[model samples]
Target: MQTNMFKRLKRTTRTALGFACLLIGIVFILLPGPAVIFIPLGLALLSLEYDWAKVWLKKSQKYFRQAAVKADQALHWFGKKLRN
Candidate 1:
């Protein structure tokens, strides 16, 4: 019973924190803060206990990585063109 109580507490805490982060992130979306960073972090935290969040986190990571790679490639190409 003690272990069960502890488990429930842990789960509840995690869920509360995750939702808090996500909600703050949403509010920040319209403000002048870092919503993009917070939202992903929230999802990442939630992903610890949720499969749907895991999938979303994976997709977000992949998209960001691809964008970074594309930006790098574009910069490299631009540099090459400038050199020529």
Candidate 2:
């Protein structure tokens, strides 16, 4: 019983901290600082306990990768056109 309570308390604390970080990150997005940085970090922490967060994390990663690829392609095209 004692051990179980301690485990439960620890889990709750982790969840609370993760949630707080997620909210703060969201707020920071509209205010200032590197919001993109915090969002992934929050998702990472929340992923530890929530399936929804895990799904979002994967989606965010995929989106960022796609954006990066597009940016690279655009840069290459721009450079080629400049050379021509």
- Which candidate comes out best when scored by TM-score? 1
Q: What residue runs in model 1 are displaced by over 4 Å at the alpha carbon?
A: 69-84
Q: Model 1: which ten-residue window has the lowest total lDDT?
A: 35-44
Compose the digit string of candidate 2's lDDT tens values, residues 7-63.
888778777877887788789978987667777787887898889999999998898
lDDT of model number 1: 0.87
The TM-scores of all predictions, comma-separated, are: 0.73, 0.71
Residue 20 lDDT in candidate 2: 81
Candidate 1 lDDT, tens digit per residue, 5-82? 999899888878887888888899899898778888888889988999899888978987897899999999999999
After superposing candidate 2, which stretches have Cα over 4 Å from the reference?
71-84
Deviation (Å) of 78 in candidate 1? 8.5
- Quick one: how many clashes does candidate 1 have? 0
